[model samples]
Target: MPALITEAHDSTRLALSSHNPGAIEDFGLIGHKVAALADLAQNYTNSAIDSSELNRLITEHFPWWNDSTLRYFPWMRWPFKVMKDPSTYLKMLRHKVGIVIPAGDGNARETAHLITTLRNVHKCKLPIDIAYVGDGDMSPSIRAFLSRLGTNVNFIDLTQVFDNTLIQLKGYSSKPFAILASRYPRTILLDSDAVFFANPDDIFSMYQSLKETGLLFFHDRTVENGNTPVRQEWVGAQLKLAGRLPSAHLANNSLFFRHHIDEEADAALVAVDKSKPDTYMAMVFACWMNTKHVRETVTYQRLFGDKDTYWLAAELTGVPYAFEPWSSARLAQEPLIDKGFPLVAPVENNLARGPAAQVLEGASKPVSQASPTIAAEVLSDEKEAKSIKLLATDTSSSYDKNQTTSRVEAPHSTNELNFPRSSHNREFHDSPKPITPNRRCTTHMVHPHPDGSEPLWANGGLWLDKRDRGLGLANWTHWYVGSRNDEALKTFCETSLPTDSPNSKSWLTSEDGEQWHNEVMNTQPRWYSNDWGMDAEGCPQFEEWRWQSLNQGFRDRLERMIEEVRKVEAAWVLELG
Candidate 1:
């Protein structure tokens, strides 16, 4: 129990001794209420996920698909020269090549383009796996469109299998992958937005490395934008409401590689039933394992340089990889060259010449290429030079005659040059349009009093009658010290006053006046009254006096309490580790 409870109970008894028996009983009731609330918090801290039910739930919801069309691909042919003691699992036969596609609603065009590009890369070879794990109803048109492509594609509709489970767990959509990891260990998880610019041999390499670790985590650059707090608080609220607290914190949407399934994974699935299932169960698994295990077994690796660097390393090193936003420059220069543009095309030329030049110039920008402005001028000159050459060929006979030759200058106009007038006009006219800044209102309105004498209902205002004011102050004092009988204070303040009672000013000198005065002084003391006086104690000297010594003692007690809670929290962390 908290020390605050004991201190509050003793203080309330001493302060309310002169009150009626009913009032004393009310104070005791308040103490009981506070203790009950504390007990609820403790129970929540100790709750955890049930493992047996979780495993059953996962197996029950597994999706069904056409087995004939679905081809299980093996990673046997991958270059394994650098690996030490390569697993025999990688050398098995079947489809050696596979493409992983993450599917969602209304992304058929992008997915189609991705498939088209992948088909182009593989040159009509290798099987493709289209993994769809979202909840929106998709049209048959999109499904048929993808199937029409020559590549073998498998659509894993997560919604069909886990319909009931997803409905039960509102936020945790990542459970399917957790279950999938244990069932189909070789499958790759891809993001819907990912585009394949080059061959994906590096991706397979990362998967091999991740198989050694129990789990793999990706780093998201946007994680710093308060996503951690938002997710943690979201999970924390669910835990608090379900009488389970202190779950793990992890980001969703990053790639994860799961090597083995254990008790902690099952526990996480149990928790998923109580709330919206998260898209990434690896995070929840990490949190649950951390709670129950002794050593950290989970591995978190970033996929890209800075953001993409780690991902790149993991891919190159043949570990399980995660995806993040990457710059266009990361793509291989070969594919860009094959399409037309040289390996090193001038950046300026590509920008000035537009998409046509971009396609012709290839993936890399050349070192000797002119700037956009210079390239535009050079291109214009080249066009004019070509025109001159054509005109010379047509008029060569006329120039060779001995007769007096007349020189004719051709008409030159901006329109005739075919310069982009609309683009130029837009650049000039649109440049001065001021960016509309977002407006924010920071003012807060205060509620005013009807009588309007310093807003009597305002803080420190004389809104209540004298007796009511005293009761109000006393009630606040009781609660601050940790008492639970707030009803008694409310009753005392609502009681009527005597008809012939003198004005509030006269009560300052009466017998009860002296007592009330001392109460007020004790409740709201001056800064100069404390041991430190004005120099150290800012205001309310009595509180400052109590705060100095009491705060240190409170710290010591809280430290001990926290240490005990840490042991409970650590149980989950240890399990995952």
Candidate 2:
């Protein structure tokens, strides 16, 4: 049982209460001590004492924390209750942590590209923390190189924060720990290979509010029909094994224990407010799922790395979380005009076209990885400069030739590249004439928001397809768009989980019934590659920009991102010298 003690000075009746024996004893004297500090503060405010005198008063009362924080003092640390080796706690109090990126040698080049993009292209003012596993993955020379890539980039070694006994950053493990090691009260974790159409800060607007739920997660591609009984059976058993009740959130989940649902939570970007209690507890579960034993034994085997665990942990802890309404979409470079601008109707795109971004920078490199304004290849194409821009840009606004280079245009449709449509380009103009969109071509998993608000970013770097990584493939332009919810699963959840059956409350389930569980376990299942939706004719969808929809912005941004990456690549080569 816990004892309760009250603060003498605070008017709202604050209490010092805890079930932990150490907490009770540690905080028992805190209220009175704080009350005395309040009097001392009042005396100083009233000019009753000098700064030295106030210092003396504090020194007289609390000697242990006098030099630490109460005078200059650590909050939620010190005096009564001491924390266990809280390495980053004080760092958190001092620094404003913004975007947290977990980098290693494989993704070092991509991470450099990302940092450069944030500073130069996105103009992200938020401080960035680049966390790596250890010195083995990111050497001192590499760290020095990255440190010079952009401003306000801080490096954190994950080993110092987490026990080496519990984690090993091979495979799909480092993503979760990066968030766990963040010094920010609110953490925004992004993979190193990620690129943005909008500034990094603005993506938060896509969420309803971080207040109601301290976390926001995006769903994975809903590209396939739900026929995953093997995985669903495991999910149901995991929920039961953990003693989790079917909370309203999971009870009506479209994926959990259901056969016809697609994957959940993309995890390209994870936004969490660690200051909230619910988020704190939920984070514990998330980290646990990513730990060695659990992740190796089941999590990685069943789910796609750390992607689905964010939502799974949140639900298991019963902490509310929000998801973006739009389902995911895949982007690919438009085929050349000579190569065929528009495909024959009803043809599927290439299977190599889909898979989110990832950092292959396994070895950190020199700082020159800073993306400059333009690429050498683009600069070399000066003869075709005006011609390329004629296709990519509408008006020949005299631009900074030094910072900008001519783009190489794929011979596209006549109506494509018709530009100067103002930033607000929702209104349509068909004078040049638009191609009839193949209805089947508007596939799901190819839509991301980035209109007036610039609400889009992607994990894969400037590759048309990630498979040809490091081969310098062009950015993907033709995107598949459209998404749908599982209406059938919603109906089934209502029918199968009956609340009136027994002693149930707050939800439909009156018992830990296995009826729905059995059905999910017995259904036939199928596996899906990320590029499963490319079956619809994916031929050069954005060859010509549509007046009503401006995928044109993404195409333009892609050019800029590629240019920056080239600059960084040159810098890295120079470092080898």
In lDDT terms, how accurate is model 1? 0.26
Off by over 4 Å in 2: 1-75, 78-97, 223-227, 241-257, 337-447, 450-455, 470-473, 484-549
The alpha-carbon lDDT assigned to residue 372 of candidate 2 equals: 21
Q: What TM-score does candidate 2 reach?
A: 0.60
Deviation in angstroms for 317 in model 2?
A: 0.9
Best by TM-score: 2
* TM-scores for candidates 1 onward, in order: 0.29, 0.60
lDDT of 2 by residue, 103-153 (tens): 887778778888887887778887788888888878887777788877888
lDDT of 1 by residue, 1-577 (tens): 2355445344534533432333211212222222222222222221131222222222232222111222221111223462333344334321133444545544453455445544543243445555554445345555655665445766665444334332322122322332332123233344333332234433334333233332333222111121232333333333333233231111212111100000011111011110111212222222222111101221111111011222221222222332211100100001111111111223343334433313222232221232334543544555533322221222222222221121122113322211122322111111222211111110111111111111000111110111221111000000011001122122222342123542233553466544433332232212221232221111122221111111233223322322222221111111111
